[model samples]
Target: MRRGAICAAGLLVALLLPAPAPAREAEPRRAPEPNTLVPAGAVRYAPSGFPDRIVATPAEDPSSGFAVAWRTGATVDTPWLEIVEAGDSPDMGAPRRIRATTRALTTENGAAHHHRADVAGLEADTLYAWRVQGGGTWSPWRQLRTAAAADAPLTLLYFGDTQNKNASLTTRVSLEALRHAPDARLALYAGDLVSGGDGEDDDEWGEWFDATAALRSLLMVAPAAGNHEHFEQFEDTPRERRVLGAHWPATFALPGNGAPGAEQTTWWFDFQDVRVVVLDGTSALDMGTARAQAAWLDGVLAGAASRWTIALIHQPMFSPRQDRDNALLREHLLPVLERRRVDLVLQGHDHVYGRRGGLRAGQATPQYVVSVAGAKQYRLSDAARDTMAPVAEDTQLFQVLRIDGDALHYEARTATGRLYDAFSLHRAAGGARRIEEHTGDRIGQRDCPRAATLKGRTDRCWE
Candidate 1:
């Protein structure tokens, strides 16, 4: 009788409670915004009558000559370049006008003309101001200095892939690097300058140019072709293939003394005491130019007369990612590097920072470095973590190389201009090389935890 009375009381309490609220419907899912590096309502990259995208490239003999390339509207044909020795007077001196070789190109952004001028017989280590003419107007004079004829102290800037977020992230890194080494003689880029190479992403090229506009006009650029520089052709078919993008040839006037088929992509130049050899790893891997480029590298290194030899390529021989090992590069190019005893190998495509002193023990001739200068970051492979010392991930970096006498000093700096790694390679008079690490006081390695799922999503560690 007591239990029944208790149950009746509970039923009366439940009946008095308000009815349960109806289930709230899920809000409609919003579509994700477009993934674009360009900002809203940004100025279009369309070419005007005035010249744009001006750049200076090292000549085969940089001591006496250099090449300049620019872009203008398609209608602005018959453009020319004017050069004068920089002097203290505002009146300046008489300028020498050189006719430009213009090539008409039709890109996804419409039609434009690319002009190249080869200015030769300039004084060594002398500064010259030059400009290009388009539609009867002259571009602002840009200054470039010739390489010294003899071996001397020099400074150079090296950057990995500036492939993504070029306008914002890359611009900061590039400008910071310029601030750190404003007088860098030559800037070496390890390819993948832009993320897209499908011929439709012309704006990316413009962003790349804008990011490095200051440096390009001031220093010589030596760049190699990364895989991303190749454009897809005959898409969605078995006959589909990759070809070198048209913008590459239109952008920089590289020394055309490379492999026969890959002349524009692979080349070498002498800048003071350093011999900068740029190889087309993309072609070597995809286009079956491995043996040819390897042979060329061997011959170039064998006949190198410079005090220092530096090789620039896109693919890393010792990849920071275990799955990214390039057997083709290792088989064809590694032997050439080891046999030639190249002093330094600067590479990209790993999207991580790794420095390997030598392939074997008690050897320090070749120092392999893979770095990135873009927003993209990759997780270091387990093998890289175990073997590659002083490594970093989730960091954008640039390297400054200063060569004084027999010693080469290298410092890797973050986007904020903080030194992250440092080292020095000293070459003895007897031809032996030694490496000294200066990374003791550098900031700790930047890394992040691997994603927990196959979708590859993780929080950004750089922030």
Candidate 2:
């Protein structure tokens, strides 16, 4: 047969064949079971003869000294820390050993002891290497720099809640923030570092420590207390009482100079040109310590000697979530903050990002910011959406603040190290403060589909 005729006959016969059926849709995967205990193959973070969760915190006067705290097994009855001034040579010259103040702490996992050592009388702006000894074993030497005695330029890293998914999600943001500001003198956490606040959830605390291990060891930590840091006294009690979690006291060695009743959670310290005042917002709201805290706050700010004052509280002055409002805080603490003219206020607990300039017109002294650095996110309230500029939802954020003489620069960056918002506050010797917003070529605000508007609702807002 001819080639063309043969080909045409074969094509016509093939065209008559039946089409193949579509592949069956894959079955939907079942959700995994929820487990509160440490996952398999994960580090248990059980206390041992060696020190772990070693954290460095600012002393009442950071220029003069700093404090270090660590966790050890109960078997280590007498723990101590050794310190030496860092020099060019490798050998540490004649280290000084200081006895640690050890406190017995019992968690769900096991009994442990937390040891704190105050390394005092150190030279200002000097580098020092220190390590902790539990029993006969010692921790690796870690280096830290003391704050300058004078009003020198400084950098600070501010973080919001790392409450949920610390090891898996929040760790990246925390590490990236440190990489972005390698010279930061202090890291101020707004609060709710761990999800479980009952103080018995050692695993959650382990995750938090894992996320900021390097930060705690390298720089000073100033943490505020959030509502999650408070545990209910009795379940379903009519008088619903809350108390500060036990872990808070054992986790960090903060300055003792705070409000009379809430010393551990409320404290202040001076680092170079700025004064950081950490308030126990949870205590004030739940434990009836608002009036006392307010009085203490006013007194603390009244005698402020630093050129700048920054306040850290867990609850937002201006809430970003519609369902939440801190009327008690606004009533008791807002006045003190305004009257004291706090330069900056960093807060958390709404699971969203918000920044509001001063309430008064032509004034920029008190800038309010609420940010979240964890995976959990919330829907933005209408009021926040309308009033707050550069607000964000479903976004993890970290802030870097630099103070140089009369000018302070602030930058808020996302988890991926992208600048989301920025502003600069400058003051003239006796003149009013001025703020300039950096609104040029920044990333757009992030928002997820509203729950009410979605066709099929999921467990999370973003989903």
Candidate 3:
């Protein structure tokens, strides 16, 4: 028989065969769901106990590397890595495994842990598989693809706040974003990855990680510190000590280059042709520390050599929610960004979705946006008329960003993958930023949940 005929006949035979026995089922059972909060005296460590967090290093070196992080109940036994080309395969399947060494360390939380297995020796624009070893057991292999090394067009994933109902619906959004933009080089989270403050329970953060498991293989996260990350001050605590509770550095190994006085809270690094600068708005807004990080922002922006400069922080200067505007950020950081002509600014905390024309210091650079992911919803204020674009309310959305040569394209997608807003920024040889808007046919509309339609009210309107 011909090759095509034989292939068809083989498929027919497979279909004609009796169904496999129930005992031969291959679907693996889901991970155990831990109690939301540990009992008063239980161990209460990381619920999933898997190597939980992974982030991409924004290095411009030949040895492109991504940092993989996981917390275990006990010391990991020789954390190893397995790698293979990411391709069409079963959810769990055989892959080539390689041994990678692990280091041990301890944190203030009384958890003796291991760190530093920086996965190096990776090819640019190539997909690689990896996993961690917790003693005799092994973790599901994670897949990661490095960004393109040279100056070329690239794509990335941007999310606002994945803080509310994070475990349930938020994971859907993150997975969908990855599903839609699988090759996204990096995923940027503009703060509020969780709900609690510095004394955060590891389990809460685990939910955030769970929401993004499907993309964990290819997506390396870069997270900012949102207001929710700040701890409330006790009476006797010193002012500086009360600001941030030091949990951030313990969790992720971020670039150490931050504002002079704000080293631990602020940072900036370049990736390919873009320089990403992150600041702790809680410090800048709470106790008048804006000047210090603002100075650092100015210096970083002025020294940037990348074609595009983007700033990611928490609070928004052009918030659509009345209760959450950041007057201090507008006064401090905006000037530095304008002076340096930064291309994009991504912020969250308002729980609403907004994309506005750029503001030099207080006036309107090229593009500024405040958005939200997860289930939290907020009502849009009347200030929508003051901006160039529309202000979205009662919406949970994610953004897919594309950088093609001299232009950048942004599309805001609803939780279910509907495009609600679209815009672009163009960079000319030497000039001010030019902004253009697109009204695509992919628009969607969602209204506030009616009382009868509501499930249960915790806080916001979407309840």
Which one wins on TM-score? 2
Show model 2 residue runs off by greater than 4 Å: 1-37, 40-43, 197-200, 238-240, 449-463
Candidate 3 residue lDDT tens string, 1-463: 8999999999999999998777766778545332234445445444224554544444433226665555554455446656566666654456555454444443324454543455666677777676775656667766666776547777888899887657777878887787688768778889887776434445556667677766665677778888766667774556434456445655665556788766766887666677888888888988568999888888888888878888998887677775566889889988777677777889888887777766444432547788899666766666754653556767778899888777888888988888888877777767445767788655744545544215444345663
Judged by whole-model lDDT over C-alpha atoms, candidate 1 comes out at: 0.86
Local distance difference test, each candidate: 0.86, 0.86, 0.69
How much is 246 displaced in model 1, in angstroms? 1.1
RMSD of 2: 3.6
Residue-level lDDT of model 1, residues 1-463, one tens digit each, is 6999999999999999998999999998554222235555554787879899988889988989999889998998768899999988876788999999999887766789999999999989999988999887889988888998656789999999998868877899989999999879899999999878533367888889888888887898888889888877897899988799878998889878998678879999889999889998888888889999999999999989888899999999899864787899999999999988899999999888998867788678789999999877777888888877778988899999999888999999999999999989898887788988896779988876545212334532321
lDDT of 3 at 111: 57
Worst 10 residues of 3 by lDDT: 54-63
**Residue pairs that clash (backbone atoms under 3 angstroms), model 1:** none
TM-score of 2: 0.91
Give the range of the ten consecutive residues with the poorest summed lDDT in model 2: 452-461
Tell me each candidate's TM-score: 0.89, 0.91, 0.78
Stretches of candidate 1 exceeding 4 Å from the true structure = 1-43, 197-200, 449-463
Ranking by TM-score: 2, 1, 3
